[model samples]
Target: MDWRPWLTRWSEEWIGCTAPDELDPDVVRDGWLGFAPASPEAVAAAEERLGTGLPPSYREFLLTTDGWRDAGCFVSRMSDTSTLDWVRDLEPYWQDWEEPDDEEGDAEGGPISRGLLISLEADAGILFLDPGDVDESGEWAAYSLFSWLAEPPTRFPSFIALMESLYAEFHEMRRPEGATRDSWEAQVEEARRHALAGDIDAAEPVLAKAEDFGLSRATVLRAQILLLIGRTYEAEQLLGRLLHPSFTPDGFFADPLFAEEFLPLLFAEHARSSSPGHNSILQSALIGDPPELQLIIAEHQARLRRGAARATYGNPEFDDLVHAALERHATDPDALWRAVGEALPRWRPRSTDHIAPVALLTHPVLADTLTPERGRALLSQPRGDHR
Candidate 1:
């Protein structure tokens, strides 16, 4: 794929953008959001010096612009042709990290010790491409590693794919509304409305975008939508991240729908999940909380100790449907979800006496069962709290 258009668009969008002190002065002087393109001779010399053919996509990228600026939140500079070198040459001890078994390489040394280091300036992060893992199209697999990430290094199929994802992160940070606080707030509210009206397909993407920009409300709203769609696993994943130790819960739980209705259901689900360390994660989130919130947390803990049934929609009608589903299809999880499909019309929103929370969207399994009339009924429910 052509790199010029992508780089041009990124540059155009980043006009007057300010970054950390790691920002390269060359980026500001070039007027292209990148340094001048490397000459064919310079590219050839790097290839000869490295003793390995550069991947096509990255080579094309270098010919377009020798290096990049602000590659991602942590990676401030992409290495120029002159600076490109092997990871082992720069950070030999990186081999101390064990390699993934599935990958074909030195049994002990992974991408960090075997790959080409492509990033020049980063905040406790490493970006590299593994030539040994080249695809049929000659694009090397790229890895983004950061000290703060507890998970394995994030991988992309190719150089451009990695760059595009980084560009998306950049856009998330500098939205068209111009980086002011709460720029994405309007989108979150609109998405909440869409989710309540049973247009979850419309709502989810917006909520996901807002969540990417670090809004706790968006994360909560999106997780509720995930649960409503019968995506219990996905919802729990979001909940796990939302309650991560680094996450602050200042403005969260202020919404009564979240505090009163959602938290109980979340705790009940946590009880059923029995995922290791989740209880500790929950307790960690409650540290330094006000007395009322502490009481609320204690109540959920007590209920879990008493072996409370896993809460579904917080409405008796819905819980009954879920219980019936469990009984009728004890051997087949998909069948139980299908039963949820059949129960959508009978399912009432827990907050209906007031207004809807994201809990109103019928499960995706309910897709086949949602007639136009049923869809309208789902959409027309009252939503959210008086406050």
Candidate 2:
């Protein structure tokens, strides 16, 4: 099938919609959608470098657009003709595969049976054309190779079939509303897919695009990406903004998917930081009466209690007392206060010198519940029965 015309039309539409002038120049440059078709010379050079004839369909794609982005394959960006240096780029991964033991009789001709890497996925997977697996037409079989998989390569009949399948998936993801072609929501969704695929770098540009467009969910997604990459401090800062009063609670926390997937990580990072600002943010997140926020609050407090116990006593079970109280009286302010009151005597001294309870009390949810006198009583109460 001649994919060039369809690919060209799609690429132009995608670039026209998504790559606004306000985006970072570097992002616009690196994004394959914004690139032009490769020169014939460049294509010839790449074929020569790989020492293999280029697949007709992919060669035509290069003529249409030198490289491409967000093709809906595992690959985040397809390589341009000049940059298709599989030998140099994939040699290390190819070498890393171990040779089969001699007793196994080299069933698949051992680790040397590697292919020509055509594109790179975010998780280090490669889409390659295996010369050894070519068809009668001399078209190589395309394989999706992953480092961790012990099974044989995922095979495609030809590069044309692979490109066609990816294009179909990409086309389906497009919305019916033309105005939303470059919408922040679309960008956010793209970033989410990249993040879920462990492609943090690929996700960043799209996230920045979302942020530039002032999408509410962008901050939450950024925090999620940051958390995934171990940038906890940055993640906490972003979450602080996300949970801030100015943003509507439903804007972020109301989504069950976000709440379930990201809230725990946000709360955990805030709890770990022990930052005053984070505690204030946590208080803000819990200030409302929404059932969703309430559940998140309970879970956050429970996590803190458990984390405190682990840090102080090397056993998370110590948090069970506090957990039981919160779980039993979650909806009743007075009853919850009493539960905290009862558990206070047992929890205070051990935790007072610690940061956990101090941080927890700073939040409005617990602050309004505990009076100065009650707090003092709990502090002065003997640790005898509690210990």
Best by TM-score: 1
User: What C-alpha lDDT do the candidate models reach, one value each?
Assistant: 0.67, 0.55
Candidate 2 per-residue C-alpha lDDT over 279-313 given as tens digits, one digit per residue, 9 for 90 to 100: 54565566655465677678657876787423221
**Tens digit per residue, CA lDDT, model 1, 22-66:** 345655566467878899999999999999889999999999999
Which runs of model 2 end up more than 4 angstroms from their true locations?
12-34, 87-91, 94-113, 146-152, 171-387
Residue 244 error, candidate 1, Å: 7.0
Cα-based lDDT at residue 156, candidate 2: 83
lDDT of 1: 0.67
lDDT of 1 at 36: 80
lDDT of 1 at 43: 98
